[model samples]
Target: TMYELVGKEMTDKWTPPWPFGKKPTILQLDELGMTDVPQAERVNDAIDDAKVETAVLQDILPDVGFGFGSGRAVGSNNWVIGGNTTKSGMPLLANDPHLGIQMPSIWYVVGLHCKPIDGSPPFDVTGFALSSSPGVIIGHNSHIAWGVTNVNPDVFDLYRIKVNPANPLQYEWNGAWRDIKVRQETINFGDGQSPVTIQVRETHLGPIINDNKVDKETGEIQGFNNKDPMALHWTALESGTILKAVTGLNEATNWEEFREALKYWDVPSQNFVYADVKGNVGYQTPGRIPIRAKHHSGLLPVPGWTNEFEWQGFIPFDKLPTVFNPKRGYVATANQAVVPLEYYDMLASELGEGENYAISQEWDYGYRGQRIIELLEKLAPHSIETLQVLQGDNKLISAEELIPYLGRLRFNEPELNEARDWLMKWDYQFDMDSPQAALYAEFWMQLANNLFGDQLPEQIKLEGWAREMWAAYLLMEQPNDTWWDDASTSDVVETRDDILVRSFREGYNNAVATLGNDRSRWRWGNLHTSTFVSNPLGRSGVSFIEKMVNRGPYPTSGCTGTVNNTRWTVHSGSFAVDHLPSMRMIVDLGDLTRSVAIHTTGQSGHPYSKHYDDMIELWRNIKYHPMLWTRAQVEAAAANKLILKPAN
Candidate 1:
């Protein structure tokens, strides 16, 4: 879908950090051997394959609905620029990783100063860390500041293996029968009933994920049949250096040290952007990217009977896309392909014929990235305040592009004509109170349904790959491209105008009913509100505990591509934004103490604690709090402190 929209030329264009002019393929990168990155099955693929059991699938959901896998479609935006592009003579960096909303929070704010042991300098770190971990996943120290968004490369692959009919425990592997490894785990129920035991089988490839049950009578495998057993091999399972790598990162002093530190950083590979007070900025993707054996791309399930499908080591760290201070002055990424096209030829050779390896095949549309670049290029000398404001910009550029096409559609209905006229004068911003934003959003949805609902189901059509720019391109460039013709209506081949008029009428009538007949009341915030709920409990049910923990129904702005990517759910066609920046960070290299940041919920998990939802209001208002770094600033801001002494 992305290829159809941007075309291979623009999608594969060469970017900075790639030293050579020559296009390199995955095969070429594999020759260098990078060796470690986080890996997960693309969630869509996992869903479509239907091999994942409902129970395991539920685990991914408590975080994001259907967390089948991590892909670029639902990711983040990050960028860094050199001092020349900044008002102050210091580099600047910003990051906001979008994820599902939850309470008790997913991030922990902390300041750590590990005293020097022996001759080493103290490891002074600050900023947000995963609530479960100690080291900073994205933060800054006195010398350098860094942030990350997922580098959603295709690192996980599913394989279909042939299970031996005579020996159910054996599977065919590279021309021989390989025995499956079984591990048993016992579950305790506290009550007197017997504990349940599960037998998990591991193949040479990885884990036999499809087999969920064993028949008690005959011992035959149940859920996933033996004929087509599915095994999942992920990069995360094989990589173990992430802890060490992140630890190294927390102590690194400069770009070189940071780069060196990342070599050990593996699972859930991320694009790391860095800026130091020394006036330096850079971007590096650190992870293990497998080189699929010839004739096999990682997009789908491959047979595991032969060695041809095995991975050939990995793409070396140096080959991972990296860029130092470029002449262009700024580096930006929005989960879109950061690698330029010049390197495609070399890498293209690695993929099968007619195949393209997107940095992450599931990347979101480039609207956000394009918008960020436009702003950066326009405001060359960026100030901290300006950049902070820019991070929350909600200008819907896609609406601007669509307005021209919509203007040309002929409408007869008076209400439709009036709606069209109103839209023509509308500002392309999804600000919370903008009625125009509501109109455009609803209109776009209806138009898309009218155009493609006949050919594709809502589930597939609404995916990021099919809905964003790809649909925009079709509406603008190929209005009469047969796709507009509803296959169900064979009586006539409907033209673009026919579909547009029908969709406009539908959207207008719906908007009137929902927002009231008064056109002025159709505010985006009325429908597009954000909610941060408790994990598992959601905002609704939780054994009578919803009132104490869940937050929001708060009005918000922005959609998938805007700087604030708060996406609403499709349920009942209501606009309850559930996905947005879990945390936002803007680093001021010129003055670490001047930097500002905010996370969705608060620092304390206790619902009664004052810090529980203190930051929620600020986040809902698109505001930020200072990231106090110096001891004096931290002490001044500290309301209470506790000193822990060693046991006597």
Candidate 2:
């Protein structure tokens, strides 16, 4: 019966698939119960491939019910500048999707086995994807590899429609007139499932975003396609599913095929990062990009029904903009603006330009991108291992100008001085034993809270605070010009100022009281902790905290916003009920032909089993083992494996 329904009122009836809306399934338990990222089954056999889209996900619900747990679609950030590539010489690709949710995690860690349908050797396509979908969502097969981070481009716009009181169906468009399209879908909730009905309307631009009437108490956002309603014609609606395209690409044999697969990329924009077994790397803006004439909807909503503001076309792939592998060896992106002003001028004839204030407003990409690039450039002999370490580095920081003032606090209070001794005696590395790092971080946050109660001030925030005085301080401290390059490369930088004596004194007092005046009491792991929860049917909870393991790699160490971070937890959604990304992997596609991989969880989401939450302890510990490479290996490494043949 579930298979019988295809595109049958999906947007209204699909209630989203998950057990008890939170637990993992039996298949999930079979695959994920492990201490490391599992290797693919090295089988010499192959089976008839199923149409993944058709066979894997069958939304049985009647109406187009929102699939996202929080009713949110997607979120992530990634960018690949023109600098880093392997050999074939292309712009490196990178992406990060910030899908908001709570618990178990949406990402599935899988290493699928495949025997080329074309009569080639079978190899594993290791990657991550939604559990229901088959194929590597973000990983390398043998020929090509890729990753996705959200584009976070602003595409949806609200319009305030001026409706005809006489005929509610008609609204004025442009200077002339037009009638909006109206439609309705009946939702069959099933026998005793409570059938329902839903009303939907559309316009030339897109769907009616808000309800026809506004809620006085709730301030609910309503939509009607007048010259003034939220008109949403995102690149996602017209294009292909990024997931499907990626799966197909995993089976691709060459770049031409890979690019062709990318051509189908649908909604929810992404900055793609690609690396092939051939060492060819490339980046692409892989979503439908609107070619708007004049800039509108920056400050306020634009009027719909106006022909003056419809999207003409999308940016073509070649013209979508990219820089291939540069002479330089490394590239990085943390969601910063891809194009500079000069580049924009070269692209559009009448580039969307208006209100200088609106133009200057920061478009999402904050200090993270700039920070990642600066750090990468400084580390010349860039290796993947270094990149991993960089992800978790924590360079000490504070107001540069205030370092001296901060230094004075230690002299002022004996208790504060104890904290300073612990901090001063250390290199700014975020080692688990480095109690000073935690103390410093806590103090920094406290100082931040004191200075900027909620959000940091425009110019004087921690980010700006470091840069302004850095050039001057670097010139003075080392005085060598090369010092600038070396100093800048660090994933993090140390601040030289201590303007907040009160914060120092306060934190010093708190730190000493808890940690004791002796340096023995000043470890960060003791203070800084990670809280994890298990939310099944009704409520949310937390049983896991920061684990202490002074071994191979660190946990949540290094720098915040640094490229290499051990503490990569996908904690998203409302605090009362959150949606967390279940897995975080650091894979190694050695030569892209065959490789090693590791992820938090195995291949499932079912609870009450070994694999369900098995990866939790391993992930929390920042320790991983080898993936299963064969049936023998899997049988040996895995707690157990089971087969669930789908009933025909």
Candidate 3:
């Protein structure tokens, strides 16, 4: 596990042997605002202490929600390579950050040109920029192009704090009682409605997310009787100047300047891929990388009263996983376990391994990264078009790996037998028109649940795409495991074949009942179509208002871990796409004008504008448009131009 390796490295107390010596800067315990209790441990204890069944515990769990700036779980993919590896003798960079499909879209194309000052040359930067954010998030200057993918580092910790028995407003931390800060917030709905006021409290650890208070008679507070208060401690609270780093990125002309800009970037850590016109390429994982103490897994909540679990310090910036001009020719990242194994071993060797620590344990199941690497290895002298093709590639490796196993199953039922034969004869690509894709998806989902649904507790039962992925691994590698058996059935142990046949029959019957009996008409796109609508307005009482304003119901290919990831979710009663790549960009350093990009929706947010949904069909067809680097190109492509003038 990534955490195990990181823990081993930390226990060893090995530091990166960079040229610069270790600095004295360390985060104070108070600065971290950590509570003395571990959140997970506290929550687990509460769940165990509950008298009700585990299934009902879901309702008891606090409904923690994501804020506007929260980072997504493992999905984005980015890559960059040296010019020597490309056809045009220029570096190639591609990025398709996976974000939720939204109506105004998440990005806007922007070009900035600063006039020359002093002896410095004028700078030209262009690419995608977020709505209110100051600079281009993933873009290119005249000298270099760069992109980003999420780097899953464990930067957030939850601490459980012991409430002072004498005073409800105090918490024990570091052997002392500290009064929690309290604030009253009143939310007004206006329109003559009364305001609702709530009291918010903060412990030394952070904000008290859920205070552990149990009603004596009911033995429940809100829902389950929580044992202790838990406060969230995240590195983002003290993140460095991200805006400054982004602004610098727009002007950075070389690898050195680019890297220098990244020094100020410290929140929502990313895998930064770099490619310069100078023919150099590099990869860096940057953020406030936490250095956990010995014996701490960084998983469960730890006691806040002791300093042992506090972060020693951030990993040295230079020490964070980095590679410059590797012999592999290209660098790719897809939110996978990116820190090399050798780095962990080196750290373990340096520091004696008696303690435990962790960097991160969450990573995407490297299907996208694996597929991209395979294509890169085969395609030397690659072009921007080559990359564009690779970006749109919908080869379902997950299905490919498991389809053969499903085909070998001999089913007793006619529908099950027919479905197995159909899967065996079909190609594994998750193209929109493939009926086989739909069948395979359903089979995978059903078989997964059948195999392991009973094995797991109701609270943690695997479901959706995650379940399918896990089932693929288990069926392929550990088919003989007792997990395949249905625990409810007595005196009958289900074998892999027994489970496979039963799951197929069940899935086939469900598919027929829902989608009808015409196998030829069972198109994956019919059910898996992507949508982009103004969610708020669409749900409004005014029906015709938003219906005329939305875009999509467009056919798309791919599944959760594929290159073109268009995922389906349970909406209403049926499946609909809830996630997909929001944009795609391919930069060719040899010629800036030749670079191309396309977002899911068009440039404008206005519903009636010609540009609003113009790109929908193009995007659905898996196409790209000229990025328009030069002023002339942008002007030529402009439908309506606006010139701002200074007013006297």
Candidate 4:
């Protein structure tokens, strides 16, 4: 089916076939399930292969979805400009990590100060830290400040394990039958429920996460059937010195020390943007990215019996994408591709001639990254105030990319034409109060659904960011492409124009129906809103408990691809913002006292506490609290003090 749409060459190239024999038929796209077809697989000759490599990689890789419960896409924006481009003649670093919006919030804002003991460096860092973690995850010390955006490298892989049918506990590895490691894990439900114990099977590669499926109705485990099980080989499984890296970063004084600290940072790769008191700006992509065999692209499952698809080793930390004081004066990353094609080539030359050096194929579209760079270039001589405003930018680049196609379409109905004309004149900002934004949002969702919804089944259908980008690509570059034809309408072949006109009419009608016929009353804020939900309690479904735990359906701005990334899914047919900047932070290297930050919710976990929801309004209003650095500033602002003396 993919071959029919994108042709054999493009399909084969993008969604590479199973490296073993015939590809296995998968019933569902489960975590341990085999790859069926890449999500939103496409063929666009006009776009450079290097540019689309990440999207193609995403398509081919099995979509296990975000490990977190959220269906929203994971992305963030982080950039640092050199002193030359800053008004204060000091680097300015800004970061807003897009994550699930919650009540207590994922970030725990705290200032850690420790006097040097045993001739060790004093810990005087201040910024966001996880309650469970020991040190600040992202922040600055006396000498330097840094921020991070996820790299989303292809560090995980699935292998089709060949089990010896005769001996269920044995698997075929390198032509020899080897014993599969089995571990019994007992999950204890401490609330007086019976404990359940299950067997976890593991091959030499790693754990077989889907060794057994559970029956939904009975809540019973269904053991492996005739089908071969898949084992996960992820970098996270390896014992990493991540804590060591964190502590090293907390104490690091300069660029060289910061890099040395990152050497121990393995697993869950991130693009670390750096700025220091010395007026230096830098970036480093540090992770344990696996190097696959020459034949494997890390796209689909391969036979575990042979070493052909096995990872040779990890890409060395030094060779990973790194830049220091570049000629561009700034380095920005929004989960987009960090390196050029030549970087891979250089790796191939250094590490063996034919080894695959794909650091990762799963990267976000460059809309946010492109937008950040554009703003950096356009608004030179940056300051903390300007950088804070930049963090709240709500311009949707995807709308800009797709709206031109609407202009080219000639609609028959007068109402449709009026709507089309209105959209054509829009500035493509997803501002909360903009009526045009509401109309455009509806039209774009309908257009995407009309274009590809018919072709893709409900189970594997494209949604949200991926769907938006793919639809835009097809409309812009491949107008007459076969994907334009609606599979449901068999009588006549549909062209791009035909689909556009039909979708536009349907979208306009749907918008009017939902938002009332009076278009002026329609506001994007009415549809796009954020609810800060408390975990377990918020999901309890009891009205009173949910009301106490959950925070607002607050009017929000921005879409999936904006710098102020308020991500929502169109698959659910609701514009309720799910993923957003969990925390916004701007570190003014010029003045550490001027640094400011705010999370979606508040610092306290207690719902009744005034500090619990205090930050919500400030966050919604794009305001931030000062990251007080000096002891005098901290004492001056302190309302209450609980000093802890050494218990002797």
Candidate 5:
């Protein structure tokens, strides 16, 4: 059987890819001291013997040639508010993590409304969980609300192991022989009801990925690289970190409680943005950060089997760098660079090394993050309307610098004159009907793709920068009846002027092909689609792999009139942020908390449910469904509610 069939089932029958150095097998209940051996094997063996082909997931990537466009369709953003800045004088928080716009979409929405002990007296929280988990992993608890963005910080490490030629599962940990921890788990192999068992191994460094076997030629283990820069991470499984965060969250009576709650966090690193009913606000760079030797950097993997590169200790939470309710009246996080380059010294001084407190390397803090900071800095007397505007802002100034260089082009037989004039009168905006905006966005993206083609030749394969300029330009320009009868990207092969024509040809071609030739055929909503599929825990498996896209654009407004989910385009980027928001309970936390969250898809994890796809239209239209938190709220939520009492 193929190793690819592993982990296809969600049962007590399996174990995770462990890093604790303990790999075990799926023991049949009968063999584990159960009295009924025959009955146990009957249920288990039937699943193990089903013959099925393992060719479904052999490719390294499902789609290789077409690079992601629409400018970072796969990133997330967040911002939090503390009590010191709220009208209610209580803290309030909000966040929206952008990610690769997947088909069976990654985020799931749910709400918890019952009263907890004596907390927030019947208040409710509406938020999402990462599909597999049951509780609201990110949401407003009761007294406060929190949002998270993938830290995307580098946190794991892989060690290149010297394998014993005879025993592949064993590798050298430190000048000595050490066997990787091995564990086996059963999975559904697709044919009939049969399941199969697969072995998993973890070395001193991490799990054996790739083919579950070392490559004979490179001697390298595949997968998350048990020897790469990320294998060393175990934050997700760290009990201290997970328990501390959860217990702390349970006691959070206000913003301060929330801060203490974050102290026990581990795994799936995040940027904590918070706000409470008390008008308090705060931000925490949450996660277990390893205190490594000053000589080592988390940017990439380091050598293992040696003492040189190792985690020194863990960082402390009290000293973790965070921004409390600043008198400035606003705080936001977008997984962007929190500290600007120029302000590095200032950040260092105000926040101390606090390295003993864990930091994350899941995502590097950079550009888009910093841009969000800069955007927030420009707000005046911040209002919900202003925050909404910020989410969907599509004004790219870089286009102005490149358009003039195109020299001569013809449209309407104006022979470069009308074309130039059209561009000259243009303001770079992706307004739905704006032709100049569309053409400019596309052209700018094209010119950029044309310029940087051969920079990184060997290491990686990614879409070039020049292509981005072309993509940004497409929003403004569309073809017309004149000098060019829709120039197909497939036709151009020469430099427009010392520029790499081939790359732009490809980038331009991609943009042209996916979106139509010119203005008349171009539509941002058409290209910016969202998919919602159901994987049924791990049982149904990732939605037939082929039925990935169940829905398309939902009258979304991104790229121009809106950059994020606005009142009109909530589906593409929005989520519910507060209960009793926008009406009676407006705490005046400015517009930050009341941003009225949304997503391009729905709340159900079930792919076939009508409610699963119902939210799309509401999201596209910038509308919201009342988040039910109490019994009355839930009852109102269900036009059809069914209560099933357990049979005695």
Candidate 6:
């Protein structure tokens, strides 16, 4: 049906043809011994069919893994304000990396200081580091302070492999049979269980992540029936000098050295924000982003038998996005698109390209970035106190964008009209104590479901926040669009206004039912809460163990896309916060001693330790502890110290 709707060229060249016609399936081709068909064409056909099937299955099947919570709102918020915009007359840098809420938090705060030795640069850094990682992931050295947010680059691709029918160990490459390299990996259990081993097949492209297709009922891997196995080509898999880059960053003095250090950062690309004692602010995007073929969009799997869709090497480090002391006096990134369209044009012109210079299509919705910019511009001459307050902002731009539509809708019921009036007079903040926030949250969720739930598949349905915001905004101009009509109701054609009124009434009723008839008692915090859960123990299923290991379902503010991002899943039909700012940090180059930071949980990993959950209240309340930088300050704040000795 989709194939007929889209027509032949669009389906054949771009999207896969849906509801596959009489075209021979992958298994059928192998069984019938269709060697006359070109391997490249055969593989492409198989890939198309597989893509269509996967799409269909994803639509109908219940979501696997974390279900609705699987798409935990991603991306971090980081910004740097130059001396001109700060009260201290020196740059100020703020960062809050958004991540899943957990105990023994993702970050381990530490201050590493090493005096210059053996003609090496002095190393003095303070900030957050991954518990398992070596150097400071985001922090400030003596001369400069830096923060990082994910760049969200498209640095990986899937290549559909065409296996040789004669020998399963071989695959087609440029019309010739190439041996598929097999690596044996054994998993040894700690409890003395039998070691299980499996063969990992690899092509020149990369490892075959999706190997032979298996029958769901029989649980048998049908070897020959698997016509096209996909091999993954990811930048992270390639050997990189990320460790070298980390060490370099820890010791780097100025913008020049900072830029030089980032050259070695090859994987997990990041937008590095810089602020130094020299009153400078800068931004740099560094990583090995692949330059793809002109025809390939990198959105779907391509034929591995041919070199047409192969990557044409990486974008040069020097050519990557960078800004030094911008005219705006500030730099910020929230996993949004880094470069402008003009940047791509310039890159193409300079590179003399028949290749696509487009870095990635998968960037954030830019809501956080926009908010950060808005604050930075509106509230200039910022100080440590002001910046700290800014980090706690819970205003939702999505609400601001969509709430106006509700004002125009006329409700029939008196209660519905009263609820609409109350919502209309409210500020768009997801404050913990706000009753209007609670009502609006429920209304927003209901509106999203009413609009797209019946039309789109379960997996692809809009689940409120950014996706729904964008959809509603676009559809607002087209009142008579087919999507506005309720698919479930055939007798009555509902317009956008009709759906809005219906959703409002339903949302009001639902909120009243959940929070009671008294509207004033409906506080956002009652439903929207945060739980700092411990791994293994918290999920052990025993009530006592869970209560002992997990922190409170604490009242919290903010929603998805807010600066104070405490994310909850609407698809789960629960308002409990699933993700939040993993760690918050503010660095004042004007006064490093004044800098402060805090993570979701405390420093200690031990569940029984008092330090385990000490910082929870402070983090939730947007409060912070001083980031001790100087030796004197560190010594003053030290509660206990341990000494190391060499075993003679």
Q: Which candidate number maximizes TM-score? A: 4
lDDT of 4: 0.76
Candidate 6 lDDT at 459 equals 40
Total backbone clashes of model 1?
23
What digit string (tens of lDDT, one per residue) describes model 3 on residues 13-69?
A: 111111011111011112223223223332222212221222322433332111111
Q: Which stretches of model 4 miss by more than 4 angstroms?
A: 1-73, 188-193, 216-219
lDDT of 6 at 625: 98
In the order shown, the candidates' Cα RMSDs to the true structure are: 7.0, 16.0, 8.9, 7.5, 16.2, 9.8
For candidate 4, write residues 1-648 as lDDT tens digits: 344454554433333221111111101122112234332111111112222222322333354322112222467878999999999999999988888777789888888999999998899999989876789889999999999888777787778888888988888888999998888999898458898888888888988766667788997888763375778798877798888989999999999999999999886788899999989998888879888776676755668888888899998888777878876688888776565434455566567756777765555656777778778888888998888778988888778777888888777788888888987888888889888999988887787777766765444445657434644554556667666778888998888888888878888888898899888888998989999889878888799999988899998988888888888776778889978888889999988999999988888899989888999888977899999899999999999999889999
- For 1-648, candidate 1 gives per-residue lDDT tens digits of 223443333223211112112211211222223233222223223222221112222222222211112433467878898888888878989988888777866888788887899998798989888755668888998789998877667677777889999987889987899998988868787447677777777887988876756678996546435866777778776747877887888999988999999999766667788899899988888877776554454655678888777877667787677777766677787766555443434454444333333344444456677678888888778877778777888986667777877788767667787789899998788889898888877777777666655654223324332134445454556556566788788898987778877777887887888889888877898878877777655544554688777777788888756877887543336667767888888998998888989998888888788998999889877789998888899889989999999999
In candidate 4, residue 105 scores what lDDT? Answer: 90
TM-score of each: 0.85, 0.64, 0.84, 0.90, 0.65, 0.88
- Clash pairs detected, candidate 4: none
lDDT, candidates in the order shown: 0.70, 0.43, 0.67, 0.76, 0.43, 0.76
lDDT of 2 by residue, 393-450 (tens): 4553322233444454446556567656556665655555676665665555455434
Better of 4 and 5 by TM-score: 4
Off by over 4 Å in 3: 1-74, 117-123, 186-195, 212-227, 348-357, 461-463, 466-468, 487-492, 569-574
> Which ten contiguous residues of candidate 3 have the minimum total lDDT?
17-26
RMSD of 1: 7.0
lDDT accuracy of residue 116 in candidate 4: 91
Q: Where does candidate 1 have its weakest 10-residue lDDT segment?
A: 14-23
Which runs of model 1 end up more than 4 angstroms from their true locations?
1-69, 185-196, 213-224, 346-359, 457-461, 464-467, 487-492, 537-544, 569-572
Model 5 / residue 229 / CA error / Å: 14
